[model samples]
Target chain A: MKVPILKQGNILIATIQSALTDQDLISLKDNLSHQVIQHRSHGVVIDITELDVMDSFSTRTLRNIASILKLRGADTVIVGMQPDVAFAMVQLGLTLPNVKTARDLEEGLTLLK
Target chain B: MEKDTESEPTSSYAYNLMKEMKLDEEEILHRKAWLEFEEPDVNRLLELNDMAQGYATEVIESLYDHFLKFDDTKKFFEDPQVLNRVKNLQKKYFLRLTNGNYDDQYIQERIKIGSVHASIGLDVKWYLGAYGFYLRAVGKRIFKAFKSNPEKALESYFSLEKLVYMDIGLAIDTYIYQREATIKIQQEAIRELSTPVLQLREELLILPIIGAIDSQRARQLTEQLLHAIRDKRAKVVVIDITGVPTVDSRVANHLVQTVDASRLMGATLIITGLSAEVAQTLVTIGVDLAKINTVGDLQGGIEEAERILGYHVTKSLEDDSK
Candidate 1:
């Protein structure tokens, strides 16, 4: 999985590639938690358009990442979930706490800025 | 040693040879033929079939009569036309099962019937009780018919039990499938309809509010809008409420929370679509619009935004003056 990081001004954007499986989620939580603390970043956007599916484990990890970032005073936004995947996640009763979803990466990046 | 003419008929001899060569062949053919015609077992199944059909009819009639005694059940059956249709279909289903088809298609139909009953919110307990009574009545009838043949009577009872179990299982599966599908559709609709109220755009979060504001929808809108503002790191948010019919106190409170939430995330919230009547209603209701940026419409809000950002709307006018 490729984790693309871009920094423009005060906003830090991370575009996650591949499906957010359990292992990926753990790595993401660890990496993001470290980055938020290290940079004292106020805004973070995670683009997940490349991901096709998100199971319960992935959703929990995203929630964990958001909560940890919130503790560090950084706000997190999740973007690029396909409509079908979004519907399935909602059906499964999974939601990322304190994280907002956007239609695309551009919109997500624009919001972070 | 015997002459050809003195021997048994040539056809009879050939038949005997074929039978000896393929003894099981005749049984296989008989089974195949039975399947194609779906003939009831003359010796055992026929009597039980009639008994099952009669029992099903009696049970279904009694169940309906029982339902009519209760107000809730009676209310569901208020439409006489629908009730009659269901009753007629139930009769037909019993007849079909008793006809002894027992094919895959018949099994599927039986399952569908069970599922349909479940979907209509039929009292499962009542249905179970009624069905159990019917089954017992049928079993008694079969047992009486085979009073002299104990082994055959037991076999008949077991077969009937098996069929009932299979049909009930089919019904439950169908019911579960229908329920899950319905929930999935509703969830999707909620998500799709709520999308516009939580979108992030460049330099601003734009929430195009439409339709009547119910308390539930208002709360959902507020949460989504706030989450969008926080995640987008937006400095400004434009909420266009042109399609809103009227605002109540609860809706007003939700709007206040939305604005506060945006501010907490370091974003300014701009409220648009203040018609004369709405503005008057707000004042009458003692809902203060102070501390909230109220614009007459989207265009005015945009111009105000341009001014706040220190951008000249008419660069051509500046050039002409020079």
Candidate 2:
């Protein structure tokens, strides 16, 4: 699934609507990275409220995306992690270390500010 | 009948008690055989059933009269309607005693009766006492009816005694089984009630930990807190462990993991209520507490959370004589 990135002034929003395969995530990371630099967006919010079953690979990808965006001078705030999905990840001992997270898009935007 | 045999056993507690007691047909028959109740005994009970049918109502009434005279059993039959209903059931039970086909169906029915008795809060002492009264009442009739033949009466009475004992055994099993199920359900409810996540403010949550933190309860608490963090959109969490009795290495590890997990979801977890003893235990155990944010007490933890959330509390000086 191609994640559509919406731009609002200097910030970018990417809402994930369904489960994405590894290739789709990699493409999303590449596309997001490219867009961050092209738009010179100061902040990016990746909304995962609709995504269920976030395995280790996705957690690593999001962490990688955050660090990569940091290098490009754009902050990343992962938003809307479902309770069950977060529980499973923590149980699996997987964590998005050194990454900023928010409850929802509104909160994410506020945090970016 | 075939459908009932297939579907009912799987769903009914009585059938479960049967399995738990290992009272399958072979086992039941083995018990009868062990009691020396053979084919001749079955025939003897059939003959006694014909004689007992005439006295079933009389025997049941007298047995109930005995029950009503006792304080413990009398309380169960306070209402006239209940007494009548039970009397009818007792009569049927009395007739079935000698009706002779002691099959799986019979055992299942006995277990159902046993479970009903258990759920109604009828003490086993009362039940056993009632059984004793019933046997004595029926024995009096048997002795009166067999004035001409004592040996035949003895054999018939022995057969009846064996069948009643079997019924008693099955009923006791169901009582124990039902008690165990009730205890298990209560334990689960207690465990669920033990962990509560409270939302103190917008983007702030508090969890007061009490008692022991076994691995199972720790896991449950972690799951509940994570869900609360998401639902409440909490950015700060204050975990107060004042009621916790001990801070063993295992418990310290669980606390550390919980703090880390909450952080992963973008919520800062502040651990508070670490008594001097617990702090000493953690330091003595050499647990890496560097990642954990600790406050001396719950109030301090809440203050710390408020500080992180950009809130300041100011004390007003206008209190005096107003």
Candidate 3:
């Protein structure tokens, strides 16, 4: 299923609830880019708290989404990565460069604003 | 039959050990198996109580006399008063075998007995041998009491055997339980002692690590450091690992992971207090720690943290305030 990307005022909130396949994420990338432009959102908050088992591709895709939104004059902040996921991210030798993160959804909103 | 059922065990250690030993269920089940059926009867036990009440003193005297023959066993009784006191405890311990109530007090008393044997550092050989002697002594009495029919006599004798084995099982189990308890306490102490985050400066936190960094310990260390960073709002975190003995590649990665987590949590991390040995080991492993700041020792690390925090300790004001 396509993950829901909701727009609140000028900020876009995407809550990743599923372990998306490569195809699902590619669609997510295109869908988020189109939605951010259509809503003319100034900020996007990606909440991955419910999401687990993130590989390098998902991380890369998220980074790509951030960069694309940035080019569209939108800011992006990811929040709620579990501590073990943070450690695993480092173990895989890929630190998400230029990726802004917060501890939770509320913090993610605050960071975006 | 009911003594102090309304009150909890007064000693926390006793309460915990009793719970750990699962004495509640054992008392109900194990004691039932021994007290019921063909093993022993209440009337026979009451008779045994009267018969063996007189035997307590004589049996204890011989027991200690026999123990004094061995240098190893004799050393456990260093004083005459201690020997006498222990003999009294042992006398009670002996008669309780046939007293046969196997109530809560019986289980508690067995725990105390086992703990004493463990604390006094008595080997199991002496414990089992002492029981063997008591069995032989009690066996002779049984044979004499029922000499008319050997078959009837053996039943009473075998009942004592079953009861004694049950006691021995509780004793050994209590000994093992006490050891495991001691180890658990020591492990908690070690964890607390090893991972301490000390605030060295207003905006500086220092974590001095001195032991092996297993996955469990490393996770605890990381958690402690992260909270200290957030609570103290620390700008620079110094990890002093001079006391660390050796590092495998896995340990190196865990150390790196801790530094990375701190960075993610918005703190600048520094690695310091590396002895020559650890430095050489890191070099051999070809581990890359270039991304994070490093210092030779605590002094150097503090100086570096001060530099980052723009903290200048002028000799005049700093020394006078100190």
Candidate 4:
């Protein structure tokens, strides 16, 4: 499914609710970048609280989306990552070094501010 | 009756051993294997019980006399009353060794004898030396009594030799088993002591890790850190590892997991005090410790924590300095 990107004033919120395929991630990346440029949003919070799995490709896509959004002058914070997911990600040697993280959506918003 | 789970404080040999603890399967099996190998004639040995009883006092008295002669051995017998009580028990043990029940109860009693010696910190050399005295004393007595019948004396001597070997086996086995059990308990104690979370200040904490950080210890570190942060309401934690000598990939992954988990708890976790060697090890493994703040030592980490605390306090009155 195409990830929903919501706008609240000058900020954009994208909550990934389902498992993402290769094409879904590409579309989601394009969708987030397109919405950030269109609305010229200064802050972005990508909430993946509902996401249960993230392979290397999805992790890379998420990192790339954040970097591209950064060039567009929108600060991005990924929030609500599960502890087990973080544990698994570290074991797989995927620290997502460049990506910003927060405990939840509320914290992510505060960090962005 | 329920067997004795706790040790008895009694010095009396009149202590009812039947009411005591049952032998475990391994002890029973071990004794059975020795009995099979020795093929000791319990009946033949029992027949010599009367002959053994005649000199039981003489055998034990000489054994204690030998113990009192050596400086190391004499120290163990300093209490005259305790010595007398132990001497009486030794006399009875000499008689019962040939009293003929090579049953489970006999095996348990033999094991108990070994445990008592070990518990008293009696040197194994002294123990085996005492057994040696008993063997020679009994053999000398048997031969003296049947000097005219060389064939009969030789038969009895061979049977006594087998019994002494079985006794040695039981005693040495218990000594080895007790030593092994001691090491296991010490290891468990070390594991608990090693994962210490030292609180440096009201807001800052330090876990000065030493030795190898195995997965078990690393897991313990994560849980303890999470609890300490929440309970102490710590703003920052410094995981100091100057004492830790090496870090493999497995250890690196566990450390990363701990860092991630601590951060999730909303504590600004800083891995501080890495030596040059440790820094090289982490880089060699390609551990992506990116974006996570790290300092060279505990002092630098505390300074960083103070800086972070100051920045937060200035930004908001509701922050940590409360």
Among these predictions, the greatest lDDT belongs to: 2
Better of 1 and 3 by DockQ: 3
Q: Which docking class does model 3 fall in?
A: incorrect
lDDT of 2 at A15: 97
lDDT tens digits by residue: candidate 4, B80-100: 876887787777778887787
Query: Candidate 1, after superposition: displacement of residue B105 in Å?
Result: 19
List the DockQ of the predictions in order: 0.09, 0.39, 0.21, 0.16
Ten contiguous residues minimizing lDDT sum, candidate 2 chain B: B1-10
* Tens-digit lDDT string for candidate 1 (B1-322): 0001212234443344334333244543453354342233433455566666656667567757876897856776677776776677666655554566555455445444554466556655655554575567667777887899988888776656555555565455555665776898998797668558544345566788878888778766766665565466555778888888898766776676666445433456788997787778888898856757889898777667666545566755455655
In model 4, what lDDT does residue B49 have?
92
Instruction: Kindly list the per-residue Cα lDDT of model 2 for residues A7-100, writing each as its tens digit.
Output: 9888999999899999989999999899998998999999998987899899999999999999999999988888778777866777676788
Question: What C-alpha lDDT does candidate 1 achieve relative to the native structure?
Answer: 0.63
TM-scores vs. true structure, each candidate = 0.41, 0.76, 0.70, 0.65
lDDT of 3 by residue, B1-322 (tens): 1111113234555556778777787464756675553434544655677778877788778878998999988886768877776777677667776776766667776666677677667777888899898889888887887789788668777777766777787778878987898999999998888888999878789898887778889878887777777677676889988888887777887888777766554567898877788778888999887766888888888888898888886676455655
Residues B74-128 of candidate 2 have per-residue lDDT tens digits of: 8878888778877887777888888888788788888878777776778788888
Better of 3 and 4 by lDDT: 3
Clashing pairs in 4: none
Model 1 alpha-carbon drift over 4 Å, by segment: A1-113, B1-173, B197-201, B315-322
Candidates in order: C-alpha RMSD to true structure: 17.2, 6.6, 6.2, 7.9
Q: At residue B209, what lDDT does model 4 achieve?
A: 91
The residue pairs found clashing in candidate 3 are none
